[model samples]
Target: MSKNPDTATQSSSGVPPLNPADQKRRDAASTLGNASQSKSSPEGVKEGGELPKGWEWKTIPDLVTDDGVFIDGDWVESKDQDPNGDVRLIQLADVGDGVYRNRSDRFMTKAKAHALHCTLLKDGDVLIARMPDPLGRACIFPGDKRLSVTVVDVAIVRSGNGEFDHRWLACFVNAHPFRSAISGLQAGSTRKRISRGNLATIPLPVPPLPEQRRIVAEIEKQFTRLEAGVAALQRVQANLKRYRAAVLKAACEGRLVPTEAELPRRSGVPPLGSAKKRQDAASTFETGEALLARILTERRQNWLARRSHGEGGKARGQYKEPAAPDTTNLPTIPNGWTWANGEQLFSWSSGAGLTQQDIQEGNYPVYGGNGVTGYHNAFVAEIPTLIIGRVGALCGNVYLTDGPAWITDNAIYAIQTPSCVAMRFIRLAFTRAELNKRAAGSGQPFVNQRMLNETVIPLPPLAEQTRIVAEVERRLSVVEELESVVSANLQRATRLRNSILQKAFTGGLR
Candidate 1:
């Protein structure tokens, strides 16, 4: 604040200046001021007798006069404004403590401001906003050139006496309890708001003029120390996030371990390119239709041979739909590699389709294509295998588990077929696949079992598949850990911020 020429008089008792006192004396005085607040009657003894002896509780209206010209107007919400509208203006964003921010915010016309009879801002004036969240946030009007803006629903407070400084009032307005009370004032179902009427009724504590100055100085000192701590933690948070992203990116790129090196590369991409491929060089089963035909024919032959006395117990032709081509119908694979549908690779089953009656306890674990959903006594699949989420939670979010599961039919299961495909590789490939990419749906993205079974899988050598799986886990583990740590630190930062506010409000800053 600029030095006011008005402070010319001295104490009638000829009290000496505060040159001889140490900081401990000032702190002691503040402590006394704080302690006296809890008592009905306080002692008159001052710090060595020159400082003020008593403090008083007051409302905001008691300290600041509603003295400035009352100003209000409908905001002209437009990008274009007259550059010549010269009466200085102060808008909401300009309410930074002890000064106005220099950002180019909204502008208003001087004529409009005059028409509204809004309060004219001046140097050393205290401005408290009547908004939400930071509604009670107060700042001092700077003693400089006028701003080309209009005061919104902000309270401009002018000191009632020359003895009390408005800057000190602004600091108190920004204090903890003040903010907490403001938080309580907000009202709305979604968007919060604080009424201007309630803003004027908030409590205020005032001490003698010089004593107020001492309190402000002490508060600023304490805050500076606290901010240093917060800043240190902030750096730690940033470093953790960076470390996490780096680890995931590196792992996905096959750089986790040195021994598990790159697989031998070919010049051109594999020729089996229709976004799909089928089973390899076997005469047993070629096309899916051919295999189904053969299965049907064999069943018919066995059915005819078994039926001797015209009355057969069970139909020999009856059979499940060839288990949807576990391995035979899949396309030809490269050497040492075999092609297989995701379903046949494991003993698979969907979650129980309980009619709400099967949802009782003592049932089996209900599993969806994604994972466990509920419990039912009856089970379709029983194994810890891969669950490719078919429906909701689109684009293949896979979860691994060995438990009783209740799943939705929206997801599919992968059970054991043979030692052809590395299960881990399948899991990682499913993870790496942007299955959700270009995936469209009104609700959460999803896929069908057919879509999943039909998706192409590049079969590298089984050993290479194992290496890839190992590398992915090694890489993702670090990322997952880092993410967890960063998330925790962020929460901790929030708690620390709240703690500082709580302490500041409960008279800790002194």
Candidate 2:
């Protein structure tokens, strides 16, 4: 009789002899059954409860053949690895929850493997990740043609027995009850890990060989359906993103709602497409050019008052005109609209520096590059102001503060805006600008006050601004509601996946 090729690598004694201390720990874990539960599980399923005839509670070691292998993976280190070597090194990342991820790419020489006493891997071997993301998750390794070995963070079990299916065992390890049990036996504080001793001792519910195959098949069949549904949900999510971008683009371009010029024409005023029509229209509606003029006058008056009170700034010399926008390459706006730079709209300044330690318990929200990162005791900006994310990945995001808030140094805000200017309109324009793309640095990109000031945007009259904001909000509210529905379904799918796994192991799958 020939020995199975899968078991050929193992010694006749099964797992290698453990040291006295390890043996003692293994014996304790095996007999006491750890937290995998003694008679019943947290899910209220009794140990081997009403298991069909021939089903039994068995430790991992008991399922192996006389020539099978049950052992911890090799303790391979980074320094021991070689890029151009013959043997592949499987890592923790390659172990997925009941699946082989094959994510790691590392190698070592054959001679190096022998020197380190590393065990070679074989197909159908169950590999368990001893450390978390959900520790003790196991998968059946579908071996590679090239020789392979895993790091010590993985444990290998090759059942070379015709009595049990490794695939079924992998599923059992991933089942909620078994994972919950392994949680109690895990060690280490900073990074949790389950020792091989504790891992080998967990009591698992094993069905008859034929039934094991049936259960594994059923689990796969159900999972395939769930995966298909999830893929559809993901596609919907992608579509929602494109729709949102389209809405913003249309809103910014005066296409989402009737343009201010068109509105004036609808009322008895002549269309402002031509300069003569614009002059002839004696419309009460303020053109963007007229609004801009009024804003600048008000801004100058405010500055003069502040200067007279010695409050504007220490370097208050004769005020110079705000810089005009460079519109040579910019898009043309509607007749009643005008192109203006941020400098013409508001005085921009960075927020004050605030660290985590400085944040105190209070009702005031601390707005940072990501908006309302934390809470603070004092507010630096009052309600109805625009905040621009100025640093890192969130750079260029626009936030409209709802209440008094503390703006962190990681953001930029309009320190002063003319009362006639609609802050909401400016926020919408900034968001549509996609400022984050203009961030300059190769690492930790940021947008400065100067960059903001130079950026050009299409501006409508204040009344039109209010109308645009209302229309955009109405459309976005509908989008948000659909997004909420999609989000809830995604979460429900996850719960359903868990429920399927829970039911499969508890004999409910039949």
Candidate 3:
């Protein structure tokens, strides 16, 4: 216990013993000295290097003030923090495209925050994420009332002098070329991260003080207008969705077109002489009920012929009559409309399995739950078929194909449709139904053929169905046109934003 302190630290290799704490302090001082020298000396800028007149090139660390701090965030676990804790914890998710997102739900106790010695963020401080959705995206911190600390991997930057503008620096950090440089310096195989040393070494284009202010002012001015346009675009997109849903709702209610009952009844009597002429006159305005009866007769005849030929012998003993849909609580329809189960109008079957190896590039489209997944040389379903998603998040989505296509097992395909029913009308009915509400699983939502077949649909007369389809298409076409314009303008706005940033850094923005 009373041994000499020097002997306690002696090395077996005879090397001189060093104090660990003293060595750490010396290393820190050396680093700061190198940064200070690099900041003050123009020699750091290579001879004949590219720089605008009156502008200079410097490492990021050089431009920072000697007292300015560069530090990562706290490493506290989520379980240790309280929901209503006194200190807010800034996370990588709380940073967005050049703006601070105040949507964080994490918080820490004030005592715990102080114990960790976390950096207290200030207004106008710059924060950048070391990791990426996009790496190196920077935003200025908007100071808040509550005590705040950021998570590890988020770098906090503070300006040391009046020579640099924080806003301009953030914008430059998000610029394309600067991002490319960051990408090159990134480490790690899967989750890429930029080390603090590498971040400090990044080159920054130092504009004159007055120019930096002007650039920031101009960027904000342009961004205000661009954001207004984006807001308007979003409103239009939301309106389009509502309009589509409204159209489908109206079509299903038989209010989208003139019903047979709305049409003028035949005033003049049919010719008294010919029975054939009278029969033709009576058949002119066939109601949905009359049409259903005819369709059922045709289906029975077809079934009888198939049975005689043994065409579907495998299904002979497995057949079970589908129960009619309960319509006691259903809404009233027009004179020529009726509520009927989907199975009464169409036959549903699951799609056969087709692997990726079975896909062959050709004109025939192969459809999965979300829509066309690939192409194949052969098709399984005929033209004018309806496909419904049967599994996963996309379950209950519906599609109609006008040409032959392959339907993959992730969806259910309509193999038969009664002539009296318009497939387009059926598609609209399904959309209004919102079948996803009936999905059966917690992890992977799914719908079976029985569920869809049992769902009730309001059927309109043949003539009225045709008119409804035409009107819906005409209205949706206009919506589609407006959507295209809005989409194009949004894209243009993005390009313009990038162009402004490019010009600001390249001396093109005067």
Candidate of highest lDDT: 2
User: Candidate 1 on 51-87: residue-level lDDT in tens?
Assistant: 2245564444445433432122234444434546655
Return the lDDT, model 3, position 66: 55
Q: Each prediction's TM-score against the native?
A: 0.49, 0.79, 0.78
Global lDDT of model 3: 0.74
Q: Is candidate 1 or candidate 3 better by lDDT?
A: 3
> What's the candidate order when arranged by decreasing TM-score?
2, 3, 1
Say which prediction, candidate 1 or candidate 2, comes out ahead on TM-score: 2
Best by TM-score: 2
Cα displacement (Å) at residue 295, model 1: 23
Report, for every candidate in turn, its global Cα lDDT versus the true structure: 0.50, 0.79, 0.74
Q: After superposition, how far is residue 237 of candidate 1 from its true place, in Å?
A: 1.7
RMSD of 2: 5.8
Give the per-residue lDDT of model 2 (tens digit) for 1-510. 122222223334232233356554444334324333234332345444454555566667667776677778888888999999999999989999878999988999999999998899999889989998979999999989899999988888887764888888898888776776677667787999887766655667676888889999998999899989999988988998888889888877888878777876677665433222225435646778877777788878888888988885732998777888878888767778888888887788899999988899899999999888888889999856889999999899999988799999999998887788777888888888999999989878999988988988888877788888898889889988988988999999988988887777767787
Over 1-510, each residue of candidate 3 has an lDDT whose tens digit, in order, gives 111111234333211233455443233223222322233312222233345676665545555665665666768786768887888888898877698888877888888887877777888888988888688888888988887888878877776663688899899889765666677667789898776655665556677888999989988898898899899999989999899889888888877887665663454432222122213534356667666666666666656666778887534654444566798899988876777787777778888788888798988889888888998998999767889998999899999988899999999988776766778988888878898889899999999988888889887767788899999999999999998998999899888888788677766675
Which TM-score value belongs to model 1? 0.49
Ranking by lDDT: 2, 3, 1
